[model samples]
Target: MIPLRAGTVTEVAVLGAHCDDIAIGMGATLLTLARARPGLRVRALVLSGAGTERAEEERRALDAFCPGAELDLTILDLPDGRAPAHWDRIKNALAAFRAGARPDLVFAPQRGDAHQDHRVLAELVPTEFRDHLVLGFEILKWEADTPAPTVFHPLTPELAAEKAQLLLKHYPSQAHRDWFDEQAFTGLTRMRGVQCHAAHAEAFVLDKAVIDFGGS
Candidate 1:
């Protein structure tokens, strides 16, 4: 693999359909970035779980994941599993978010995600952030809908382990879910790591990119 670098990423935006989605999808990458670039700006948005314990969990979780970063998070109260029904609201929210920040990188769900809410946000993200580099993060679930990712962010074993621990630690409400466990998180990262020649890593689907090969 010829590694591509997103040089000097000072700001990042992460979007999710649910409270824990961002953590589940790209927690390790957030950790890696925040540590590397202290005071990196992180703007996060979640479509559901506002005004509830889930939102609180999400806030604490993001704080842990994005250490030493400027983090702004917004969580809406849209009903879970019913995002498609509220298309306009979601789209407007995304538009407002887009107007607020021009992030160096955006992390969102892929278009082919099995979950309805995730798929909706994935479809709308590009409509607003038209000219940005969006890396679609994957959430593993009971459904068999994971994609063959076009990019991989390799993580060290320590960071991978820390990510798993943080997930388990920060999101206590998600602990009941069968798929939300250390083994599952570690196993997925390990598998992706093997694919990218690393001990552990997170994968992302790149639907579009404008590469600049510098030379003269």
Candidate 2:
């Protein structure tokens, strides 16, 4: 187990296996980070595959959600549903990120997820970046057991609503599924809010926070 702490954070590197993962997982936190810290740069990467044209859909979706921060996105054109199949490609991607830029903060999915892609991403991230602060975002599902988040942020009802609208409206293929319905989105937010004793909030599974305890 890793002890967690909070400190000044500026940069963010968001890694996802599909288009909607980042938005559905940690969209509000990304929103909060941008607003709190001016001139913060976000690097959003998608280990995309051919499942549903994920390469293009997410690029436009992110543009709509985070309007101010121009997305420094890297769309990895790896085979979808085949992330585990190509170990070399995944490693190369992680190595390239480390070799180029080191973000102060990292956000990815948790290992408890029901989705195979999400689980693999969770495993891959820790193996690559060992020292930076990492937060795991939740994706609602029947298998989302023991959801624990020590770092929580309240999202305005309007912001939460807008996020759902973005997820549903921007990704038309997703809205066709009932899971992306307004009720479903609201209910998940409500549940997380209840856990954190807030009206509405986004939760992050915190780990390995690199904070300077000494007075600076």
Candidate 3:
């Protein structure tokens, strides 16, 4: 894997349309990053599920995923599956998040996501984080919406297992969903690993990246 030579990301911004989107998409990647860099700054924003059980679930889930980091998370009350209708509020939230800190990396839903809420947030993230490295994470669901990921974060077998267990443990609200299970999570990561010649992996779709081939 070609590494990002951005000189060690101290802060990262994670944007999600719903509670478990980030965890479902990139939980292993977050664990890997946090373990590599203690005290990494993680600022997360979820558009929906504020003042609900889902929001609480997300707060605890992120804590598990981002171990040893200073996590700054905000759960907004935007209605689920209605991001297009509340464009202004979402934009304002993104603007406020951008103004607070210039994160070295950003994670958000990919533009091709079939869900409208995911698609809208994916479209909006680039507008706010113009110059930062933005990795668009894919969430597998009932619809066929997986993109050809250009980037891959290879997860070790242990990390892959940890991610699945953490998801199952923290997000009890999602346990009722048919897709929320260990097999589905591990199977997808294993498939992604095959693409990158690893035991497991979390992939991402990114539009642009500046490579520094000068050294090493």
List lDDT for all candidates, in order.
0.95, 0.75, 0.92
Looking at candidate 3, the ten consecutive residues that score lowest on lDDT are 1-10
Cα deviation at 97, candidate 3, in Å, is: 0.7
lDDT tens digits, residue span 1-216, model 1: 889878899999999999989999999999999999999999999999999999999999999999999999999999999999999999999999988987999999999999999999999999998899999999988899989998999999898999999999988988888998999999999999999999999999999998776865
Stretches off by above 4 angstroms in model 3 are 1-6
Candidate 2 — which residues are off by over 4 angstroms?
1-7, 50-52, 141-146, 210-212
Q: What is the alpha-carbon lDDT for the whole of candidate 2?
A: 0.75
RMSD of each: 0.9, 3.2, 1.7
- The full ranking of all candidates by lDDT, starting with the best, is 1, 3, 2
- Name model 1 segments beyond 4 Å from true: none
TM-score to native of every candidate shown: 0.98, 0.87, 0.96
- The numbered model that scores best in lDDT is 1
- Over 1-216, each residue of candidate 2 has an lDDT whose tens digit, in order, gives 243544576668888887788988877777777767766778887887444556567877777666677468887777666777877788788778766666888888876776777778878888887887778888764454546777777778887887788877677767666577777777777777787677678887876665566787
